[model samples]
Target: MDNNRLATKPHYQILDGLRGVAAIIVVFFHLAEPLASNHLDNIVNHGYLAVDFFFLLSGYVIGYAYDDRWHTFTVAGFLRRRFERLQPLVVLGMTLGAIGFYFTDSTIWPLIHTVPLWKLLVVLLIGYTVLPVPLSMDIRGWQEMHPLNSVAWSLFFEYIANILYAIGIRKLSTKALACFVVLAAAVLLHFAVTNANGDVTGGWTLNFEHMRVGITRTIFPFFAGLLLCRVTKPVYIKHAFLWCSLLVAVVLFMPRIGGATHLWANGLYESFCIIIVFPLIVYIGAGGVVHSKTESKICTFFGKLSYPLYITHYVLVYFYVAWISNHNGITLKQAWPYALLTLAGTIVLAYASLKLFDEPVRAWLRKKLK
Candidate 1:
C-alpha cells in the first residue's frame, strides 16, 4: 500500500521515509528467505509484518486525505484516483516478472519451461487488472493470482479496502467504525492464534486459507489506522523519525520467539505487534517534523523511492532465489556478490522506473482520466 496520499494532502514526511525503510528491510527479508528452511529461523523474521504496517499507513493516509472530502469525493472519483496511483507500478511489476520469468527457470520451478507461451501472456494480461486468478489459471506452481508478481495479492486486498471505504466506511459514525474495527480484530485474533504456522503469514496463494489470510491481514489494521486518524490528538515528539524508524527495524529484525511446541507464542507476538505496536509507530511518525535541511532531503528521497522499490525489487528477488536453488548448498558468503547485485539492481531499476515510466504515465493519466 505505498499509495499516492501525498497528492491529496501534505504528507507526514517521516512516515514516508519510515515506509521506505520498511520496504528496504523487506528486500533483506526476502534475501534471507532463500536461506531459511522455515519462518522461525529466518533472519529479518518479522518483515512480513511490514505489510500490516503498510495497510495501517494506507488507511490513516486515506482517512486523513479523504474523510473530509466525502462531500466532493464520489465513488467513481475515488476509485479512479486509486487506480491511477497504484495500478501503473502493478503493471510494471507484472511486466518485470514476465521479462524475468524465463531467466529464472531452475529445478525449483522447472515448470516455467513447460508453461505455454500463450498461458504466460494470458497470466500477464490477468495480472494487469490486479485481480486474483483461480488455481486453474496458475501457470507457475505457486498458484498466485499474479504468479509473475506475487506481491500483487496484497495490492488486490488494498483495492478491496479502498472500495469498502469509498462505498460505506467513510460514512460510518465513529462508534460504528469502532464496532467494525472490533469485529475485524476478532477475526484477526482467531486467524493468528489458530493458524498452523504460528504466525500471520501465507496470503499469496490462490486458495481459501490464503484468501482468509489476506483479508484478515487487511481489515483490522486498515480499520484501526482509519480509527487512529479519526481519534488521534497530535503531540510533538523530538527525533520522532529516527525513533520510529528504529522501532520498525527492531520489530522487523527480532528473532522469532517460541519453538514449535509453543506455536501460539509467536502468533500472539505477531498479533500484539500488529494490533498495538504498529499504531504507536504511525502516531509517532504522523506527529514528527523534519529537523534540518539534511533530514528534509533524506525524507524526500526515501518518500520518492518507497513505492517504486517495493513494487519493482521482487522481480530481481525471483532471479536470486532461482539462482540459489540451481546452485544447491550455496552459502550467503558464496552468494554475497549476487545478493549485492540484486539489491543494487533493484534500487537502480526502481529509480529508473520512477523517472521514466511511473511519473510519465501518471502525468498522462491525470491529464486524460482525471
Candidate 2:
C-alpha cells in the first residue's frame, strides 16, 4: 500500500485549534471546581460544556472523513482505525494516573490506602480498552470505572458513537440524520430541565441516571454535527477563528445563569448552547480560512495537542485536588502558584507524550495495520 494514498483527510484547522482551546479551559475549570459551593457559583462555570463541543467536533470530523469512504471501509476497519488513533493516549493517561495515584491520597478519596495494588492494576488494564468497570470493582470511592483516570468516561461514550456510526448511523440519509438529531435534542432538553441541578453535568459516574446523562450529551451534538456537515455551504468570514474562539470562551466562562429560584432558566441556556450555539461555532470554524502561516501553525499544534492534553491533564488534577484537601480547603489565591505549576506541567507532559510516545506508537500501528 502506498502510504501517501492513506493520508488523512484535511481538517477544519480553526476547529482543531478551538478544540485545544476548550481542552485548556476544561483544565482550568477542573481547578476551579473545588472552590465553588455548587455549579451555579463555580468560576469558569460552564467548563464542562467543553465535552459537548468536543462531541460536536468529533461528529463533524468523523462524518467528513469516513461517510463517503464506507463504500470500501468495513466496520472492523473503522473500529481499528479509531482504536489505533485513540488507544495509545488512553494507555499513557491511565499509566500516568496510576503512577500518580499513591501521591493523591487525601480525604476526598480516603479509601486509596486500602485499595489493593492488584485492583488498581486491574482497572489500569481495563482502562487501556476504555471499558467501564462494574461498580463492585470500583476501587476508588467515587465509583468511576477508570478510578485513576476519571476523564476516560467521555472516551467510552466517544467509542459508542463511533461504533454506532460504523454499524448503522453512517448509512442514514440526510433526512434520517436530521430526524435523529431532533430526537436527540429533545431528549437532551428533557434531561437538562428535569434534573435537580438543572444542568447537563454529572455524567462521569457509572449508574442509570448518569448513563442517561452521558447518552443525552453524546447523541445531540454528535448527530447535529453530522447533520451540519451534510447541509453546510461554507461562508467566508473575517477573523472567524478569533470570533468563534471568543464565543466558546464566553459561553464556557459565563457566570451561571438562573440560580436556584429559576433552575429552568439555566437548563434552557445550556440546551440552547448545545443544540444551537456549538454547531454554529463549528460551522464558522469550518468555513473560515486560515489567513496566515502563524495561525496555521498554531492550529496544527493545537490539533496535535488537544486529545493528548485532554486525556492526560486530569492525572495532575488528581494531585492538585488532593493537595487542596490536605491543606484544609485552600483558597484560589493561596493555590494560584501550585495551580499555575500544574497547568504548565500538564502542557509539558502532554507535549512529551505526543512527541515521544503517541506519535511514534500511532505511526507504527498505521504501518502494521496498513
Candidate 3:
C-alpha cells in the first residue's frame, strides 16, 4: 500500500479559486436574467449550471478529505467538524437577515404572519443542509421565500455522499454499480412521469417536483467525482485523452435536444462535464501548474475566504440592486458598474470576515476540540 497516496493533503488553493469563479458565475447568471429583458439580443443563460460545478468540486474535495478516514470516522466527529466549518457563519447570516428584516420597513408583519417561528427553527436546525421551497402556502398567508437558507441544496447532497462513504457504500463495486443504475432509473421514471403529466413548463408544485428532479439530475455528476477520487490514471497521456472526451461530451449536450426523447440526455451531458472538469482541476493542482509563488498566494487567500464570500455575496447583491434601482432604473448597459462594485465589495467583506471572525473563531474551536 502506498502510504503517501493515502496521506495526500489535497490541494486547497486552486480548488478555492475555482469555487470563487463558480460563485461569481452563479451571481452573474441571476443578475443577467433580469437584465436580459432589457437587451434586444438573446444571451446564453447557463450561469445556474455553476451550481453543478460546485457539486462536482464538493464531491472531489470531500472524497479526497474523508475517504481515507471512512473506516474509523465517527458520526460525532464528522458532524462536529461539519458544524465547526458551517454553523457559525450560517447562524450569523440568518441572525443578521432577521435583524435587517426587523429594522427595515419591510414589515415584521410578513415575518410574523408568513414565516412561522417553528418552521424557521426547523430550517435553522437542519443546519442549512436542506433547500427550502422558494414559496409555500401557510395558514396565515401566502409566503414567498428565497431560501434565507440558501446554499444548502448542495450541502444536502454532500451529507448524502458523506453518509454513503461512512457506511463503506462506495467500497462495494457491485453495490456502487447498482446504486448508479437505480439513480439512472429513477431519473428516467421522473422524466416519464413529468412528461405524462404534461408538466413540462417549470413551476412550483406541492410535492416539490423541481427539487426531486434536481436531485436525480445531479446524481451522476456527484458520482463522477467519486469515481475520479477512487481511480488513478497516467497523468501525461491517458488522463488528458479522458479529459478531452468528457469535454467533447459536454459540448455535444450543450444544444438543447428537444422533447422527451432527450430527457436523460441532459443528465448524461452534465455528468460528462463533471467527469472531465473535476479531474482536469485535480490534475492541474497536483502537477504544480498553479503552485507558482504568485499563483499560490492569490489562490490560497481567495480559497481561504471563499466560503465567507459565498455566504455574504447575496447581501452585497441585495444592496447593489437597491442602489441601482434607486439611482435611475438599471439597464443591461448599466449592469457592468453594479456588477464590478458588488464583486469588489463581496471580496473585500469576505476577506475581512474570514480574518476578523471566521479564522479566530475557528482557531479557538480547534484548540477547544483538541
Best by lDDT: 2
Q: Per-residue alpha-carbon lDDT of model 3 for 1-370, expressed as tens digits? A: 2221235475755556666655655566545544554322214234445555665566667667776675554655665666667656665554444434322222223444456667756544443433344344221122322244244445555555555555555565845745774575456345534453222222212246655545554555555556556664424433332343344234322443323454444444434444555456555543333536776676666567767877666655555544554545567676787777777777787777788887788767756764
lDDT per residue as tens, model 1, 190-223: 8788889889997888788898899999999998
Q: Weakest 10 consecutive residues, lDDT, candidate 3?
A: 197-206
Off by over 4 Å in 1: 1-7
TM match of model 2 to true structure: 0.97
**Pairs that clash in candidate 3:** none
User: Candidate 3 — what's its lDDT?
Assistant: 0.52
Q: What is the lDDT of candidate 2?
A: 0.89
| TM-score (all chains, Cα) for each model | 0.96, 0.97, 0.70
Q: What TM value does model 3 have? A: 0.70
Runs with alpha carbons beyond 4 Å of true place in candidate 3: 1-12, 38-44, 102-146, 174-206, 234-272, 275-288, 322-329
Q: What's the CA RMSD of model 3 in angstroms? A: 6.4
* Total residue pair clashes for candidate 1: 0
CA RMSD, predictions in order: 2.6, 1.4, 6.4
